[model samples]
Target: MEPDRSTPRTSSRRGFLLTGGALASTLTETSMAQAATRARNTGDADAAPGSPQHPVVTRPADWQPVAERLDGVGRLGTDGLVYRATFPRYDLDLSSYGVSGLVEASYAAFARYPDGRTMLMGDVVATETELQRVTDAVQAHGLEQCAIHKHLLAHRPALWWTHIRGVSTDPVALAVAMRAGLDATATPGPRDPDTAPPAGLDTAAIDAALGAKGVSLDGYRFSFARAETISDDDCVVPPAMGVTTSFTFRSVGHGSAAVSGDFVMTAGEVQQVVKTLRHGGIDVVELHNHALSDNPRLFYLHLWAIGPAVSLARTLRTANAATNLGVVTPDANSSMSTES
Candidate 1:
């Protein structure tokens, strides 16, 4: 399952936004668990992934000052392991038709792996004008762009999404580089925390159609996540932060929704998952990985479509069935903090 390399995602200023961000032709799919299969490149037997695991570090606290430098608060995840910072996209007023900032914000999670190296991974919400600079900054600062593509097919002001990953002993330097790319965009500072949006769509119907649970977010979108337990450098990273199979539904009125989000899959499953999406009338807009060396070598398939909400959900359920996934039920204690 090679990324469509022929479809180059060049950062050469002029062609950064070309497609190949995702690899899908046409297909459709549903279900709970797809068989688990590992993806290995036969030709590249000596490929090197991001980094190796290491012993415990002397500085978990080292990440704090870096968070402050980014002007974002760093939270010690309740898991007491991963350190995370949120950079909300409050700057883009997706509200002409009402898109939630929760849906648009960019964030990165860092973990001091048992292997001693700290790794950072996150996404940035970029506009056409800011895309190139942000891309340049991350690459310049030693961070890698995992994916660059759009979320909404028809959005006002037009926004593009870029997924980034990096590993270093100096977490603050990684944060500094991340901040540099962010400064290129108009993405605003964090706002007073907002409540999950009120729902206008038939929530129960939507959940049933998708075969998974969802949360109401800012009356703008319904979101769900199927998390895969993945790790790097001998440290554990939660599903919500980086590698979750994410789904979002925004009401288009009369029970229809504008659906957008990504599916995390192993290389072997890409074509099948995409085939299922196409069968359901969904568009596979972007197909790429979230990290350079995720243990299983995961790929994220970003999709978009507008239709009867329940019908789209069911098709998503079919596509979900094509991946190796754990059962992702709604958390009764789940809050909107994981909104993105």
Candidate 2:
């Protein structure tokens, strides 16, 4: 008989985990014993594909220690599943095309599994000179770099974005490894949140054009999760872990805005999404994958376009119609389990 699909697997037991080509040196013998106990209890020697496990609902207080470890402030999503910390690249003055309002920031998102493992996923924005050092630091600490590419079309002060991933029973350890990578760059420390939306941009009109509502960050932003189950190493990967389609709009001038974000796509949907965006006159920045062992093999296409805010949103809506995007929810994870 197969192991019960409901049995939760430990973080240290994934046979396909890719952490710089080896398991983190910090995973202890105790973790190994725990994995063995779980396997014995379930009567399964190998991990079996099953329903993606839901992320545990986490409160801000639950992640206070993690924030301390990262030496930055974090905000829990409205859904209470993923806690995210942002490190904007205020140190770098960048520009693409003639648009000077380049949205440059690094982020690390943490999600808790039902089995008590914390998974880390986010991207680091690094200058060309700082890329290798950042990679070396993360690799030395047992974290994995899922993907590396650019988010701008033709930018000065050349930059690279590297997606990082790690899973550990000790969330602080994951924070430490992530911090090591950030330390390699000149990313600034925490600052006040930009509560006000960009001036002269009508977000309501944007919502009407895109057929979805958006929230105000430094600029206006929107996120949509893929309709199908997304799994990595046979474990469910939540939308909050940098897996969703995202768009961030910042006012350029004269009621125009600069939009930058990525669309999460599968192999069959790739060409159509790209063609659709190009047909709408949007600039496709880069195409790549964000995870190594994800089922269905996801693809991420970064995009940039400067136009009237509503027009850009409508063009994005046309591109979105090409994928399997579901309803728009605020930090949505409703299908997954949430703690009371």
Best by lDDT: 2
Error of 1 at 179 (Å): 1.7
Write one digit per residue (lDDT tens) for candidate 2, span 1-340: 1111232444322211112211222222356654453343234223354545555555576777778877856777765567777777777777888867455778888876655567777778899999999999987777778778887788988999888877766677777777888999999887654658788899899999988988776668888888987777645676766678888888887878888888999999999999988987789988888777777689989898888889889899998999999877566322110100
lDDT of 1 by residue, 1-340 (tens): 1111132221211101001111111111121121111111111223344333321212234455666767856565443344567666766666423544325667776655432345566778888888998998877776778777775656667787787766554556667777887888887776654445434678787767766666664333333334445654333445645566767677767887777777878889899999999998998877766665456677777787778878888888888888877766333113232323
| Global lDDT of model 1 | 0.59
Q: By TM-score, who's the top model here?
A: 2
Q: How many residue pairs clash in each candidate?
A: 24, 0
Q: Cα deviation of 108 in candidate 2 (Å)?
A: 1.0
Model 2 bad stretches (over 4 Å)? 1-51, 332-340
lDDT, residue 137, candidate 2: 90
